[model samples]
Target: MISGEQRVDPELTTVIESVVGGTPCANSGEFHYSLAERRWEWSDDLARMFGYEPGTVRPTTELLLSHQHPDDRATGEAVIHRVEDGEPFCGRHRIIDTADRVREVIVIGDYESDDQGTVVGTTGFYIDLTDALEEERNDALDNVLPETIAARAPIEQAKGILALIYGLNSEQAFAVLKWRSQHTNTKLRALAARLVEEARQFDPNSPGARTRFDHVLLTVHELVDPAADAS
Candidate 1:
């Protein structure tokens, strides 16, 4: 458990909550894995997502891998191995829950360090995108336009950054970018451009990169020039 001084920023937490709440089809929750202890901790929502009643069962790496779709089990195991080796953990894959329902999810996390500044584990989010996929497919079909091709470059780059950091597919990544654009009152292209520029400086391998990127993603809108967008 995090101490008061080490707690995440309330505003940042609110932003994440809003993002999860705003979408009816998206179910998301936080998780942590302690490297030294080889232990897993799941939020109640995550437990529910796995078709288990909260607090009813212990979360373990083996339990997590057992839930992976047969075809994706190797991929899931590799992600855990990478995290164990002190690398960022990011995976977009499918899993079969206790109810025998298949769900697609994204696991995005970064290294967690102890008070001594030693990397101790990993912490991040699990985002279920099963229902959202159909919605995004319909939106994609409706929005394709020849004229929009010119603006796709930076937007695509921004989407890639979001995908890598958040473990979202291209569609979900675009949805996040669009959400930020609308809420921040920033033009979509301008917002994407700003995000791409800022992300260029982010090094995923660096210590504390995940927390820093979270701040950047939440507040980058403030850095965009409205007048420039207007032009």
Candidate 2:
């Protein structure tokens, strides 16, 4: 039912379809209304964007806005309002994409007019910013994992050295280093850095690297953190 409170214009529907990504079927053509009486239709892409599909989704503007990142919501809402009021629409905002990935998108919307030139409906364009968002996510992960969690110091250096020589992932190399430290009775981080330095100085294919690593492991364990051997 087109509720008594709102009247949606028709051109907006076409705008959504044009911008929607068919493969992912995300918010391509849906517009929402704040007043309860408004009834509008949505394209499948739009349905998907708001976390719904062809059969089960309820179309609402609130649904669309709710997925917006807090930082982007205000600007997005204001732009939509200007379009609804017959003003030109333009903005960029961040939203949580269907994959729960925060993406930034460019928005451009406008309304249609009848022969009388009265505002009949509105349409909008959305361009995905998933790439930008993905970059942000990667940066955030690097900052958090390398700086906050994990064994803070030489664990990473050892991992890099192992990757440089043995062609192992950081996680795998770390497991090997930790296991070797436990066997030799040494502190994990210090033992890792010592292994890294030895690997840097000697080639693993030469066999002498192993002896050097062991020798340094013993010396560092004895000289640096003495309790490391006991632990």
Candidate 3:
């Protein structure tokens, strides 16, 4: 069932787990595959991400494919083929965990090769985006109440503002806002409320409000895109 052989890199796993720990999304893991042996290796976090006990199961491409949501299997196989061809892989897919819960995930990886330029393996990280995906879907559903729409209007506006200012897509913008909410020990809605309120009071021509707004912008940028700051 394994599309190809893969193996886990312990050092890479440790590094990735450490990196993910400080992010807004903690449900993520690192994976490696060995093309020569047709084997797979998974980090403990990756194993648990798929609802498996760490080291309890021998990882394989087939096993990973089996956990994918039925409709995503073809895309998943296509990703594997790309990896085998020594190309970088980036895709969003759905996985049915052992608990039978369908989780949305984003996987990003690159090939590993030797001096001869032969692709030996691939490595990457999978991050769970189920909560965000569900929220977006719920917002789009027609069954929502009028009051619910009214309540979400300000938050959606705030998200748009963040997206525009930060050059982020809607989901990443919301994630940045959510991360700020948690880091500051504020309720998500309450924090969003403040964002809206602050913008409401802004006087575009006044340097004072602009300076204050700049502070908020800097704080959000720091949290949401620390990698950018690092560079």
Candidate 4:
């Protein structure tokens, strides 16, 4: 037993490790905040994810937020507050790794609470999408059949729109669109049409568009394949 007022399932830790180990372009870490002791616990992999040698740095909310990119720091703080407030948290953010590399990551965590429903801690995984993003940035679009060019025009248009709106490369944009299509039970061309139509209705710079864009990215995590994530 953990032998604390707040107990963690040792098996949950094991499952996290196993899933992360098998997952591509991803790593797992554990965080446990001792509310009473005001202390923090971190897994070695979590340390590495933040560019620390295992067992070297003491983990804290402040230290974690420090690794966030300047633009993402406020969002990181909000995530912490959500955890402290015992809300399930999910977000996309950027972190500066130990070597000063900027890594884009998706974080998903749920709060831990005592029987009395007081917040005890938060645990979750940080999945690195930097590799996929890089690949998207570097790879050229594949050759298309001349006969199929017209059929693919709307798709290409949608890809262009997504690329412009989300700062993704053409291939990455297409991948995201395809994922959304399959997950939503919509046909590819239909989804492509919907995306283009939706984009046309909003000024890209408008706050509503930005908000919807953020929500789209958040929901797209389900569409990301583990293998593609690492690539």
Candidate 5:
């Protein structure tokens, strides 16, 4: 059992390691903050995600908050403050790394406790969804499509569109598309093609992008011909 002042707990570390290992994407890393010690620990992957060399720079609350995107700083700060107060942390936000790259990430964690069950700190992981989505897009582009281009291109593009708009992982995005296809009684390819075409009209960086996409996603299937085999 870990004592209140213990810097590291082997058993807790093992559990964290197992979770990171089992994650579908390699774009995730663990973190721990010791409230009593006011110390922070970060995995190498997390450091890289923040555009820092592992062990080269110290991790502090200010440094962490500084990396948050301008629009998301308030949300990030709230999560940090809550964690500092021994509360669980779970938030999806954006960060601007050292190289000025924007990354969307999900941070999930719970309060860490000592042997006597006193809250000692917070432990959690960050999943870099932007990187994962980009990788998925690249992989889709690299795939060898069978026969007609109509068979795969629209579906892949549509999946990417949904993933970004809904903050969904690749599998979840695909499942949603399949569900929509079934419910609308439209061919998957046709539905995807219509979605992709509609999505093309919106500027993703705009404030209303999500709202526009939400409307498009809900009604794009209506535009697709149910009898069409290819979009």
Candidate 6:
């Protein structure tokens, strides 16, 4: 029945008495939609992940929704509606914090009941996902092995040039280039595939002979801005 911007609930200072003495309150908000009287508390780590101030967040349901990605709005609302229907709920969404930076989160809640065990409320938790997201992304990046080592961008373009010039698969071309680097104890991407192309251009019978004489110039062109290459 919270039809507008009005909030009428117990002051957070009262019910959180257990931690009131020495608890470092960062950013927190209490919600009382019906009979549930609960306050959500976040640690300093959580606040940092959401980019919020330690003492200045109002922490309303609307604020949480505002942080969601536009595409996720309906899904998030549907989840909330389902939770209000008395089902145990777990959901993940993006949220913007006090600093206006976006963050990922998983919200979990269950039925709250009175002493008689009658269900009276539902309380939820917001767990920051910045660390988890970064870890997952890094893990995916790690799976690429050598391509990941070279940051993919440079190596992809370098692979394209090699595939075109040597009539070899990109993987095979990269492997040959890698073998050369390992034999010479040099960074694989340092010379890029242009060096290999130079070797291909002349002296096909020589082990390390190259003729392009401008490996540096071609490498610069291939490795710079792989994104624009897609364009």
All candidates' TM-scores?
0.62, 0.42, 0.51, 0.53, 0.54, 0.38
Model 4 global lDDT (CA atoms, 0 to 1): 0.60
lDDT of 5 by residue, 38-86 (tens): 8777878888889988878888889999998999898788777877887
lDDT on C-alpha atoms for all candidate structures: 0.68, 0.52, 0.60, 0.60, 0.69, 0.44
Best by TM-score: 1
Poorest 10 consecutive residues of model 3 by lDDT?
221-230
Q: Weakest 10 consecutive residues, lDDT, candidate 2?
A: 14-23
Candidate 2 residue-wise lDDT, 143-215, digit = tens: 4346424655677766555433333334434544554454345778667656555556766678555435434
Q: Write the per-residue lDDT of candidate 3 for residues 3-112, one digit (tens) a residue.
A: 23334434444434443554544477777777777666776777888888876899766787789789988767767676566566556678999999998776656667
TM-score of 6: 0.38
**Model 2 local distance difference test score:** 0.52
Q: Model 6's lDDT to the true fold?
A: 0.44
What TM-score does candidate 2 reach? 0.42
Residue pairs whose backbone atoms clash in candidate 1: none
Candidate 6, 73-150: lDDT as tens digits: 875775556445544454556666657666565444444455786866554334444544555344433443455346
Candidate 4 lDDT, tens digit per residue, 134-205? 554343233222322555575777777655554455544555566455434456765665555565666778
Q: For residues 96-119, what per-residue lDDT tens digits would candidate 1 score against the true structure?
A: 999999998766555667779798
**How many backbone clashes can be found in candidate 1?**
0
Once fitted onto the true fold, the runs of candidate 2 whose alpha carbons sit more than 4 angstroms away are: 1-37, 97-99, 131-231
**Steric clashes per prediction:** 0, 9, 13, 1, 0, 1
lDDT of model number 3:
0.60
Between prediction 1 and prediction 4, the one with superior TM-score is 1
